[model samples]
Target: MAEHPAYPVGLRLTGRRVVVLGGGQVAQRRLPALIAAGADIILVSPEVTPSVQAMADAGEITWHQRPYEEGDLADAWYALIATGDTEANTRASAEAERNRVWCVRSDDADEATAWTPATGHSEGVTVAVLTTDARGRDPRHTAAIRDAVVEGLRDGTLVAPHHRTRTPGVALVGGGPGDPDLITVRGRRLLAEADVVIADRLGPRDLLAELPPHVEVIDAAKIPYGRFMAQEAINNALIEHAKQGKSVVRLKGGDPYVFGRGMEELQALAEVGIPCTVVPGISSSISVPSAAGIPVTHRGVAHEFTVVSGHVAPDDERSLVDWPALARLTGTLVILMGVDKIGKIAEALVAHGKPADTPVALVQEGTTAAQRRVDATLATVAETVRTEDVKPPAVIVIGEVVKVGPTATAPRE
Candidate 1:
């Protein structure tokens, strides 16, 4: 018999019975999609993989916990025959055929009534690819095609302006430490969809270059104690652009909630009744230290890690951090925005209880090509920063975990 071209159509199986003949790897892969389709799934197998068992435990599916019966396909809108038992799968496939239920056979697609396509989703659109030839089908090739289409849609390389629905609002996107690739997929997609991007100086700077010429890029860099854009002005700018019917993205370095003053921006937008979407990014507090080969927490070295903002001096009334309490802790202490006040911070820590010789490391411009690590003890960190001319936008790590990694043995600048 000559092979005929398969007609492709999506099945609406919500609240309908779908029989799964196996509980092994093949069933494990197919069940989630079935559940997602809102199918009332039935699994007939004596045993199942741990992950499949988890789904059953979670009340996501019904488990028969027995061998396939002759009438297992009864009332099933669709069937998947993936039992490792050859005879059982063949029998199940025959039952599906007699009942006219579309079946997918894991062992033999040629004999099955239906073939699952390689499917992907991007921004409310689903991309499904199926390829067949005289010899057989290439599942991997089909998946690759599906991936390419989905990626293109996600990054704005493929655009159907007529098909897309544009909503004017603000998205608080965290661009991650510094690398453009480090940005989250959702954050990058929002950037691709944005009409106006108000960005910080620290996050993924290179991503701005990739934007189309129509995109308006605003420099909202709030450099500490330098030429800066005021917070009030930035808030007004977001409100102004969004009111003009444009999609605005406030892209900040690291996670927005982590000392990024993201809440203030959100509250300001909330007062005017403009909706905002927050996409979290990898915080530099933990990532910067890791990039420089320092683990904030280590087994038998440090049990806990505390992240503190050192923008204010320990002696300053505006400072909220308890220097005495922090100095007494045995775990790692990661400080941000402390370059200018490192001397006072060091003095307060030592004067309270922290040993002067505690190991410390500062990772400057972390996760970028210009990344560098400076090492010193608590006693000498102030003078070290002075002699080394260390700048802002660096993570300062204090504790024994700094001395645990391989960088501890490496030469210091």
Candidate 2:
């Protein structure tokens, strides 16, 4: 009779010994997942990639630092023999077999007793896909299927059995710059559970398209034009929705605390005795410049980086910023909501003692498909802004750190 198929089961590898008999690309790819699983990983190899070596140095894993010995699998519950040397892989596999431990062969999967599946996780659900044909199965095909399942789970096309309860409360979720993929896993999971999403114009809008048809979407920008009224109305909407026993997600771009007025909303909810949760997002102040290939801070270039709101012009009486002190300080200055007042802001900075030739970068719609960069010096940035017609929702970076990193651009004369 034919043998039964390999029964699928989840392994609780927390604190369990997992022996990896290689330190090449295969090991590098597998180590991270194993680390996430809380495995007690012991890597046996003569040399390792820089990243794997860093992991060992950080005490995340143990490095054997030599060829695999026959008895290395003594107490290993699982083993992966992926050494480039055929003889070493053979020895490791044989030792695992002698100890009755499940062995996965990276070099010769056909001879192995176990196979790694294409895996992904969404909303606490782990999906693992394995092909029946061991000899010539396409990994990319399996991976694509895994990705489709994950996307479905994330976008609410597929639902998990243990989905989060649609609690009647507010979640202030930071959408993370502009990239849909940049959002936190918890934020995505909470979004899937949202019955009403009060969204900002700058938040990841692509995700909204994936929401279930039953979900209510409110636009913060459409709530009357005066800034104070608009924010007050948004706060009212959150309380109103949650009071009606509906789950509300206040989806904002970047971080809620980074000039997002998240605390104000929380305080409003608290006044009504409504419990709220805040899931922080990747702030655009740093991510946007990085997307344009600029680091906000660099070693010896700028020790400190300051992010300021340019919504109010420096000369405005309501503005509390010390422009002269800012100009005198020597570090990176990142300005948000400053595109409309770039000319005045630039002039003020230069007048106060900031060098006219300080490099500046204007990253528009950063981390998105339409991301564009305009490079200039502080003296000429105003003109560059006018010439390029740079729009709002852009990040303005000023400092020598702009000259460092991969995407550094030459300043315009």
Candidate 3:
């Protein structure tokens, strides 16, 4: 009779010896999950990637610093054969079989006794996918399913829990750069469980519509600037709502501390003895330019990138930024909230000795379906902005890196 299929089980490998008989890319990819599972990993390899070496330096894993030997799997409960050599992997698997230990061979999964499932975690729940057929398991199929499940969890389409305890508290969740998919798993989970969502104009607005009907959605901009409620009033609103035992989520765009005034709100909440939690989001300064296919710091094009707020013009008395210093640097300059002041900003940079022809890219509504890019130079960006009618909430990238992309050419009118 044919043998039964491989039993799928979640191994409780905490503090257990898990021998990894390689230190190549496969091992590098699998080590993180092994570490997360609390396994005492012993990596046997003559050389490892810098990341694996760093992990060893940090005491997260032990490196044998040599090729696989006959007794490598002696005490190992599990083994991973990922060496570049197929023969080495086969020998390691044989040793694991001799020791009655299951072995996962990255080089030839079908020849091994175990397979690593595509895995993801959300809000304390771990999802693992393993696809097996007459031939063997398909990693691509398993990973696709895993990604779909995690995507559903992040977007709230996958129903887990609508109500977590209604304990009075505040969670400062960074909603990531515009894309709802980019938000952290913790941030998304908290958003689903919030009793009141105080949201920003630039955050993941699509997520607000997904909240349960019972969850109150507060437009932060309307609550304060639109309705004449000051920052103090907004803070009071949080304190008052939480005092009534409601969970308040301050969902802001990008990272809360990246010129988002998240600390100001945190301080306000602290003065009233309200406990707050901050979940960092992906900053647009970096992600936005990336979405437009612009690298803020490229290997030889640019070495450093500076992120600054452009709400105030460089010539304004209230402006705190040193325009001359910024102009002197031959690096990338990322400006947020600067569309309105583009004319004056560009002039100041050029006047301050930034190359008049320095390339600039304006990414509007970056990382979203409506994202658009307008390219120009420091000398012509003002006219380009006018020509394109680029609005606020756009990221302005300035530097030589802008001219290094595949399609980058002379500035367009």
Candidate 4:
């Protein structure tokens, strides 16, 4: 059994100058979290994404448009080094120590001064597991066992936001690709014990059915590519729910942190002295591809996979997608929310480098009985989907694996 983090050092990072040395989605994901924790964040990265620039422009954070400088760590209470580049992250972690500031290395948790546990929170209690250990599963064995246990709990117990606090926890549950059953068992248990469930409107409803008849279910669901929920509003709700001394389960579709605005909520909960933990769910970005018999990473056919939302922005002006290069790439491309952009996305792929006959499949409601896969190609996918009336909440996968029909059952070994 892994030893629990003794004394569980929970530091208050509020109002502290925290320098984050990477400003892409990883940092964007981390920034809202730190800000919610009340950190006066200074983001330093040579390159920044539109999200980072927007956050910087909004005065939600301070931006330093250069690589990490030795002086950047000065006076900073804490430092997070999450640059996707491994070398830069290592150097930043080292630099933070030279400045005598506490540091957390985002790329390598074990290398940090304090490793952030994969958390499960509700009520007032946060269960930080270095890794959940149900006795004996050595390393690799342990991880699988922990995941199984966690998944089982999500699907079975973590649904209700109950009045319990002593064993308080929050399930950062992945509602699972719009399919309720895809949610893990541990997620269900957390829901069952919830006193408040702050959920995305698009998350699966069947999963919510697991909650006891009277459990409080709060719908914080955001409309698709529409009037996005003000982050502050959702933040306030999480704190308010947890402050009620009730277990709040943020039942989001897919993994809460994976494009689910979960980090924002967690930071808010942390600021108010309410512990926050996450229960991860399968991201449809890849899950949908898998359910449709597409291996995101197939040996020679495709070695890399990129998942970008086709709905990051409704109009095409500021969206930064290199359709030309993406079309020619020999890797799987999975897109979410491109029902409207399906025609354009497919055309772009064909116009660039993909074969007109390249296999494309649209898997809707993956991992559930209602799951449906519509197979086509770069040339015909758009029209095929349109004619079939496939709707949003569908994941589009383009790769050779689609031709394999991965949905077929495997023969017993």
**Against the true structure, what is each candidate's TM-score?**
0.94, 0.79, 0.78, 0.56
What's the distance in Å from true for residue 348, model 3? 2.9
lDDT of each prediction vs. the true structure? Answer: 0.90, 0.89, 0.88, 0.72
**Ten contiguous residues with the weakest lDDT in model 1:** 221-230
Worst 10 residues of 2 by lDDT: 1-10
lDDT of 4 at 170: 59
Which regions of candidate 2 fall more than 4 Å away from where they truly are?
Answer: 1-4, 46-51, 155-164, 176-189, 224-229, 270-275, 287-304, 339-344, 355-391, 397-413
Which digits, one per residue and each the tens of the lDDT, describe model 3 over residues 390-413? 997899999988888775656875
Candidates ranked, most accurate by lDDT first: 1, 2, 3, 4
Name the runs in model 1 displaced over 4 angstroms: 162-165, 222-229, 410-413
- Tens digits of per-residue lDDT for model 2, 1-413: 01334556788899999999889999999999999989999999999999999999999899999998879999999988889899888887888878899989988876777889999987568999877655547889989999999887876667664465655899999999989889887888788878899999999999998888999999888866575588888999999999999989999999999999999999999999999999999999999999998988888989899999999999999898999999998899999999998888999999999999999999999999999999999899988988888998899999998889788878888
Model with the higher lDDT, candidate 2 or 3 = 2
Residue-by-residue lDDT tens digits, candidate 1, 44-161: 9999999999999999999999999999999999999998899999999999999999999999888888989999888778888887662568888889999999988877677667
Ranking by TM-score: 1, 2, 3, 4
Count of clashes in candidate 2: 0
For candidate 3, the 10 contiguous residues with the lowest summed lDDT are 223-232
lDDT of 4: 0.72
List candidate 4 stretches off by more than 4 Å. 1-170, 222-230, 313-315, 406-413
Supply every candidate's count of residue pairs whose N, Cα or C atoms clash at under 3 angstroms.
Answer: 0, 0, 0, 43
